[model samples]
Target: MTESHPHPLFAHGTLLDPQVQAALFGRTVPTTPASLTGHTAGPLEIADGSRNLRREFGGTVEGAVLHLTERELAAADAHAGDDFARRRVLLGSGEPAWAHLDARPLRPAARIVIVGDSIAYGRCDPQGGWAAHLAAAHIASNETGHRVFNLAIPGSTLADVAAQTPPLLAPRHPDTLVVAAGINDSAELLAAPDTTRDNLSHLADRLTPLAATALRHNARMVVVGPAWLDETRLDDYEGLRFTTARALALRAALRAWCEDNHIDFIDLWEPLRDRPHLFVDGVHPTPDGHKELFRHLST
Candidate 1:
């Protein structure tokens, strides 16, 4: 029997492409009529101060586990290349599940928690993002031997992270807690400096409490500070100039706190602040920008 005519196979991520899969494995695997059980995809929310995802309103976000054929497996391996390290996990029913992961292992046994905004969620790139890049780095190195759960939601605030963290961290018992915020706060601060200051002050207050809770559970906490803005356009909003300036001050303040609190600081501002092309607008980072940040984090 030919390899392509073997049992059914399941492909995920970029491997989902038949041509790509074929290119990798040097053969094609036929799809089977089989279906994965326990495959309900509802909005997955945890109490980890993790941000919320933009779920389909009134719809269930279902996920599936596919069964891959030998030929398909070969193809997947080829497509995955060396960067994507693969793993086979045993499901509850003793079924084998293949996961094409990155080369580095941030924490193998320890559960690592990542709480942030859209950047953590890989907003633009499906295969590339700082979080994903970080995960790949971890898997490749096996340094900490931890698995990462990135709880980044688009349009989320630090308050949202505070609200949802407890539950998310409860189940995982994560050893490391990483937080990323600031961009949203900056824009909000730009809108109203006084109000933004008050808001951020409240956010700062929440951090101590959040950090205490995390530490009580023996989790190490880290904060990724906000990046710097292109203040050359400050004249565009005379009313907001003061606010923007204040926001810059707040970034410094946040850094001071991180230094004092022993939180990890992943600042994206200095690396790409003046580089206008790095930003999609006055906010989010471009793909190259994200890659640069990932490289910075890795280093």
Candidate 2:
């Protein structure tokens, strides 16, 4: 009976966008033809110069009616950010619903903002990284809203990403941020077992921007920890602690932090645990490795 929320909702803008709906509600809300009158539908400009929708007094705007719970409505409010506000309005069904009006623009459906190292930027793998595979898969699916931008630098540290990327990404207001750090940190920053844990914890506060943005949008922060590297390439790693032992320890520490902070953490170790051949240079994943990574992501 969907009784959690006694009120329904009126969607006219991004809420009506299939991808947006899926993102906010975890699935698209069932809607029927309905609308609001006494308001002209105006295009609202996003910070990125894209257009969402706004209602101005003049004409009728055709939209849909969504029966949602109070919890669901709250989720919508957060997802819309301060740029969008909800006003109580009457649905065509004669039921009360929240009408989300745009005060700003949002990322178009399907644009995935990925922040990571060369892996995200498609290092040794010429086919691009797992994120690219993800974007492509989504584009071909019913979820055609998946476009990806890899903001990964070749030799970035957790500290580097923390200091540089957030401000640039703040205006975009990403819903989910995929972070694949720890390799640079582990290799260049770690010396001992305890040192590995210490280094990871030190970068915790630097990661606040991604966490803050996600919270602001009722979104998610996903951390993709270091993958299993081939121990045979020890010398190729410049004698850094890309050692299998160090990588495993760093992975454990990162996972613990995510859990403590209530963030989602993806461990590449188990998925590629048995498939050592998936690595092209004992560090980065091959196209096949990326596909396996994509499989985990899809799940």
- Best-matching candidate per TM-score: 2
Q: List model 2 lDDT by residue over 151-219, tens digit each.
A: 888878777777766665556544456777767777743344354344555757756665665444323
Off by over 4 Å in 2: 1-110, 142-144, 170-173, 188-198
TM-score for predicted model 1 compared with the true structure:
0.55
Error of 1 at 10 (Å): 48
Q: How many clashes show up in model 2?
A: 6
What is the C-alpha local distance difference test score of candidate 1?
0.55
* Highest lDDT against the true fold, candidate: 2
Query: Candidate 1, residues 64-123: lDDT per residue as tens digits?
Result: 243466655555556556544344322223344444433332322245678888777777
